[model samples]
Structure formats: structure tokens, C-alpha cells
Target: MANILEIKNLTKIYKEAQNEICVLKDVSFSVEQGKFIVFIGPSGSGKTTLLNLIAMLDKTTSGSIIFKDKDLTKIDENLAAKTRLLDMGFVFQFDALLPEFTVLENILMPAIIANKKAKTYAKYLLEKFGISHLANKFPPSLSGGEKQRAALARALINKPTILLADEPTGNLDTQRKEQIFKDFAQTAKEEGTTILMVTHDIHAANYADKCYKIEGGKVE
Candidate 1:
């Protein structure tokens, strides 16, 4: 399989007053298409920083982030925003669902933002995730695991080429967490979506095709 994403000599530095903090130091890796990749580390490690850089949520100090052969580090904000909306999907620790919207509506939000008609595909996603029964339900009425499943469905509504997940299972219990991991692995294989996830939970390693350990600003 070809590499869908590449990170080379990536570094990030944050300046606070007179202090300078380096979160990621010359980190590098490549992700193959349709593979589930996970970065596990303790709090304050550069795992989240790495995902932020790839998602273009944060800028890199100096390095290259190549996605589909395009240097994301060089793209302007407008193009980056378009790339994020059209080609990439994100799921963070929180479900981030709107309480007023039905589960189906929430899943279609991204497609709506992109001016695409994807209601049928959204329904399919819900069914695939085993949450089709919750289509008419509001987010507040759903359980923690159900809400996360809805969030996952929302992320896939656009058929994004890559999925960026940051501690996506953080709020779930053990059973739910493991189920989410299984879902991710299956999604990667069946949907052909390259997945890059960052988390402190070591259990995620069991589901990943490639696992990296990040600590003290380095990956190994």
C-alpha cells in the first residue's frame, strides 16, 4: 500500500513569556493507506501535538507534513480549511454533538457544510456503526457509547480519506473503549480510510496495525 501521510523532522515549540517549551522534537513517521496507526504516551507527551500538526489545527515550527503528496505545511489557511472539511475527519475526546440535532442530522453536518447531499450515506454509516436505531434520537438522550458511535458516524459522513482521532475513547468505560477500538480497526480495513490516533491508553495498541510510543518529545 502507498503511504497516505508522511511526517519528517517535525518539531513544535511554544513560547510562554520568557520560557520556551519544545513539545515535539524532530519526530518522523509514515502511515500507509487503510492502516490504523496509534501513538500512545503519558500526559504532556507530544502525541496530541503530532495529530494537531497533521490535522493543521496547529502549525509546525519546522518540518514537512505531506498528505497525498501535498505539503500541508505550505498551504494557506483557506486551502487548509478546505482540505480539513473535504478530505479529513476528526474525532476528539468529547463527542461534541449538538443536543438539539437528531443523531442523523448531527452525522450529516459535515456533508452539509461541504454542500454535499449525503443523507443516504449518513444513514448507511449509522447502520454500519450499529446505531441506526438512534437516528431520530437527540444526543442528550443517548448513552456515552451511543454518543461516541454517533460521533464516529459523523466523522465518516464525508467519506474522508483520513481520520484524525485524539483520545476518541477517553470518556468511555472499558467495554465501550475496546468496542470503539474494534470499530476503528474494522473501519480502517473495510472503509479504506487511513487512521491516525493519539491516546494515553495502551490498550489501543492491540487494535493498531502500527503503534508508536511517544514520550519526552520523541517517538520510538
Candidate 2:
């Protein structure tokens, strides 16, 4: 598989009151197409910060993030937003589905934003996640697992080149978390969508094709 994203000597810092705190220090890695990569670390170890940098949700203090031969660290927010919408999908631990919309509508939000018809693919994703029956229900009416499943479907509705998830199964039970990991693995294997997930669940690393650990603001 080819490299979908590359991070070289990436670093992030926070300065307050004349004190400098380093979150991610010279972290480097490459995500290949169709592979599941997980970062396992303790709290405050910069896992989410790293994900934010990769997703363009935050800026890097130094170094470079390259995607498709372009350096994302140098891009303007407009271009970054456009690139994120066009090439990336993000799933947070909480199911961020819209309450006013039905599950189907929530799943189609990406397509609606892009002004493209994705009903067929959205339905396929719902079926694939075994929640086709819940499509017509509102988010508040669904269970946690169901909501997360719908969120997963929504994330994939755009068929992005990569998916960035931050502790995606944190709100679920063990059984549900296992199911989510299986679904994530299957998605990467079948649809060839690159997956980068950050979680403290060491067990979750089992389902990933590549696993890295972060300690003292460095990844290995």
C-alpha cells in the first residue's frame, strides 16, 4: 500500500506564564492506505493532540505533515478545511449525531454538505453495521451502540481517504467496543479506507494492523 499521510519530526508545544510544555516531541510516522493504525497511551500523553494535528483540527508548532505531496502544516485554514472535508473523516468517542435529524439524515449529512447524492452508499453502510432498522429513528431514541454505529456510518458516507478516530469506543461497553473494532477492521480491509485511532485500550490494539505506544511525548 502507498503512504496516505506522512508525519516527520512533528512537535507541539504550549507556552504559558513563561513555561513551555511539550506535548508531542518529534513524533514521526506514516499511514499506509487500507491499514488500521492505533496509538495507545496514557492520559495527557498527547495522543489526542497528535490526532488533532493530523486531522487539521489544530496547528503544529514545528515539523511537517504531508498528505498527497502537500504539506498540511503550511496550508491556510480555508484550504485545510477544504482538504479535511474532501479527504478525511473524523469520529469522536461521543456520538456527535444531530438530535433533530433522523439516523438516516445524520448519516447523509456529509453528502448533503458536499452536495452529492449518497443515499445508496449510506444505506449500504447502515446495513453493513447491522443497524438498517434504526435508520429512521432519531439519535436520542437509539442506544449508545446504535448511535455510535450511525456515527460510524456517517463518517464513512463520504468515502474519505482516511478516518481519524479519537477513542471512538470509549463510551461503549466491552462487547460494543469489540464490535466497533471489528467493524473498523472490516472497513479498512474491505473499503480500503485508512484508519488512525487513538485509544488507551490496549486490548483494542489487537484489531489494528499497526500499533504504536506514546510515552513522555514521544511515539515508538
Pick by lDDT: which candidate is best?
1
Candidate 2 global CA lDDT score: 0.92
Residues 18-112 of candidate 2 have per-residue lDDT tens digits of: 99999999988888899999999998999889989988888899999998888999989999888787789889989999999999999999889
Write down the TM-score for model 1.
0.98
Q: State each candidate's clash count.
A: 0, 0
Query: Residue 77 of candidate 1: its Cα lDDT?
Result: 96
Q: Provide the global lDDT of candidate 1 against the true structure.
A: 0.93
CA displacement after TM-score superposition, residue 79 of candidate 1 (Å): 0.8
Show where candidate 2 strays beyond 4 Å: none
**Least well predicted 10-residue stretch by lDDT in candidate 1:** 46-55
Tell me each candidate's TM-score: 0.98, 0.98
The residue ranges of model 1 lying beyond 4 angstroms of the native Cα positions read none
Candidate 2 local Cα displacement, residue 218, angstroms? 0.7
lDDT value, residue 106 of candidate 1: 96
Using alpha carbons, what is the TM-score of model 2? Answer: 0.98
